[model samples]
Target: MKRTLISALVAGCVGLASFAAAAGTVVVNGSTTVLPAMQKISETFMAKHKDIQVSLSGGGSGHGIKSLMDKTTDVAMASRDMKPAEVENVKKNGGEAVRFTVAVDAIVPIVHPNNKVKDLSMQQIRDIYAGRITNWKDVGGADARITVVSRDSSSGTFETWEELVMKGERVQQRALLQASNGAVLQTVAKNPNAIGYVGLGYITKDIKGLTISGKAASAETALSREWPLARDLYLFTNGQPKGDTKTLIDYALSPEGQVSVKEVGFVPVPAKK
Candidate 1:
């Protein structure tokens, strides 16, 4: 009886050890623009590291950074850099925020396929969102009021647009506000007169992308910085990541992960020499 009990105890201990060895979770939260690519990366990472799992969610860039600062998430995905106040806040809490550039992206202005306007100069786009140019005909389209769609203030995309396109101007108070790239795409795709923008990765055949200042938004243009709306995508951590978090961050900057970035329609980071 004693020998049988010892054997059963040893078997149970081995099972518990196996279960503990296979369990780890990495939580990532942030930008909707980065969500798709990260989702792909996470899937690949998990397959190779069967012991680790990645949990991802997108509430916007601000939320992601906030999650990191609050110690609720292992990583934060962002379409924009951390703000000055955000960095200061981290320092106050005895933590440092570190940013990792993950990909290059172009904020492509999208309109419905039926819209006749194929291109708009930078100033024209600014004017349209500023509510200074309200009619489509003013910009070479039909004689209809342009429905301006914009991302909300919390979005990193919105900050980039405000910097590059809005140019110190505000998106007119009446413009429709969306929470995610996909939402903006859908809003514009369904309305011929609507104009909106999204990360290059979110572009689909359903919406037509407008050229700005005669330059199309493409991987080549974005990487070359020839596209005026080009910007870098980022991942943020409380500090230099360690363990599972570091592994994921390193993979994202790895060649294979960069391929996933390109596959998802964003420009890959330039390879290191």
Candidate 2:
């Protein structure tokens, strides 16, 4: 619970004509999927700005929206956009919501390294998650139970699943609930019977990505909006930020932030040009 001051760590960039560290405290929450790169930005930004305090936390996008609505956090980092009703709820609760694009992410479907299934279409994935296709044999893999590791209800990844695959239906009672994307990746990587979806950043050597309808989940596809599962990552603020919140948001949208986006394995916005 040590407090970190932004200006103390981010002073060098003050005169760079990018983001001037304005004075004040800002709290950011949500998007554990993007936390690694976001945290990198926080460390670098804090080095250049000393007067502002920045606290970072993640409990998934749902936590981000909840904290914003309750007026507990100044910024919400989201792996996905807010749902329409969620936006309305924020306004009804006396909060103003504005979204800023921070980066791009893909929902990479993955399997254990040994699984022979290397490709799957979006429809096939949806069917698998919907309980309509219950075995790997049905998807051109081994004849296994096709145990699914899923982000818990509080996660934005789960929300994406509901919207894109489940089409608003509830998750089956048997879907294994994982606390975070990392956990899902870990579980799926270790369990041959497991299949899971994670953010592009979390797609690593431990688990192999499955091509979606012959297209791969990658930065190029994500930036071009070519991959059907690609999504724009976000930072949400309550109304317009005028101080440190604005500063951090500006830095995140700036070239430096986009570079960090790429460094952490996500597709940088604007294709890093």
lDDT of 2 by residue, 1-273 (tens): 001222222332233221122346667778777676677788778877877666766678888777787777788888788888888988898777899888888888889999999998877887788788898998888888989788998888788777876777676678899877777877897899888988887777788889988998788898787888778788998788767788898988888877877777877777344
Best of the candidates, TM-score? 1
Count residue pairs with overlapping backbones in model 1. Answer: 0
lDDT of each: 0.86, 0.77
Worst 10 residues of 2 by lDDT: 1-10
RMSD of 1: 11.3
Q: List per-candidate RMSD values in Å.
A: 11.3, 6.9
Model 1 TM-score relative to the real fold: 0.91
Question: How many Å off is the CA of 66 in candidate 2?
Answer: 1.0
The Cα error of candidate 1 at residue 47, in Å, is 0.9
